[model samples]
Target: MNRKQEETETPSKYMNQMIRQQQKQLLRLLRKAGVMPDERIEVRDSELLIGLFSQIRRLPEFAEDKKKAAMLMHAMDTIFKFPVSRATVQKIYYRNKDF
Candidate 1:
């Protein structure tokens, strides 16, 4: 990539790509080990969580009901553990999704 491209890319965007590459490698390793890749979610990928939330947010049920918003919040709480702050999740959750 050129310097202009590198300068334009957001850190989170770059991180997401790296995380995806790692996940692909893990899947390959799992296959080599005769493990069921679908049965495991070893790493918590924030990009994925955000994508799920985005899709759920698009749902008419979730969009029209305040109570349904609680479900997404609860899912976020369950998704992140200690050392990963609510602020961190919020930062990622609220960041621009242009990429």
Candidate 2:
């Protein structure tokens, strides 16, 4: 690699960027708080896709219950980016009180 290429970019980095853009680009913005990964890997499209989706913390829309929480927080309900209801929140404390 030339000095200019070494200082500016590498083949693997270039490939990962291309792969990310190619898949899930058009519909990504439509997703709620869609976030791009800060890191990229030199892998095939299928492997890169696995890395992309493996970290998502939610169930698919079809699998989730669409009903809103009894205690809605106006129009926004995400607490640190995970959807939860008051009942679900209450469960967080159950472990402490359980004997």
Candidate 3:
């Protein structure tokens, strides 16, 4: 690729890596907080997990921990490139309750 192409692509690549790292961190936090059972969660189930995280963040226990709550919010914001509505999250959570 040309230098211009490489330059343009580098930021996108870096951003993707950063996002993946954030996701890993978020997963660790969720597991530590007993919000997730496993270290590896499917991408398709992300919406459900996001909804659960949102609920957990709202809990008095998590709310009191500003740092963790902020991390969760950041993770949620980074995960969805497009805006995801609360109603959509709730629907995903309900539909995948068994997950």
Candidate 4:
């Protein structure tokens, strides 16, 4: 492809790779938190993962559930590290009020 086509494709390719990496990290975190089966990591939708994090953060035992809390924070940090808009993050925070 020409330079213009390459430029357009590059960002998409990078985004896809980043998304895959993020998904893997999320799966790891879920497994570590014992929220998912340790034998296999399923590829779940981002929204589902986000919802799980939300619930984790809202748990009454969050203060005492160190492992799960740490995993939830790590997942949130990883997600925020991506190039998402501030508004998007705000929306997430607002939707998950406990976070």
Top TM-score prediction, candidate number: 1
Per model, state how many residue pairs clash. Answer: 0, 0, 0, 0
* Overall lDDT per candidate, in order of appearance: 0.63, 0.38, 0.63, 0.61
TM-score winner between candidates 1 and 4 = 1
Pairs in steric clash, model 1? none
Q: Candidate 2 at 99: error in angstroms?
A: 18
CA RMSD, predictions in order: 14.0, 18.1, 12.1, 13.1
lDDT of 1 by residue, 1-99 (tens): 557767987456678799879978987898788884344233466666665676666569877985676668656655455245677765655554632
Worst 10 residues of 2 by lDDT: 70-79
Comparison by TM-score, 2 against 4, better one: 4
Q: What local lDDT does model 2 show for residue 58? A: 28
**Tens digit per residue, CA lDDT, model 3, 1-99:** 458868876556667799889979998899899998653323555565676776777779777887777676666654553245646654553342442
In angstroms, give how far residue 29 of model 2 lies from its true place.
Answer: 8.7
Q: Residues 1-99, candidate 2, lDDT per residue (tens digit)?
A: 568777887656767678768655643653534564323333334322332232221236412533332123211222223244435443442223322
Q: Identify the superior model by lDDT, candidate 3 or candidate 4.
A: 3
What TM-score number comes out for model 2?
Answer: 0.18
Question: How much does candidate 1 score in TM-score?
Answer: 0.40
Off by over 4 Å in 1: 1-42, 79-83, 94-99
TM-score of each: 0.40, 0.18, 0.31, 0.31
Screening candidate 3 with a backbone cut-off below 3 angstroms (N, C-alpha, C), the clashing residue pairs are none
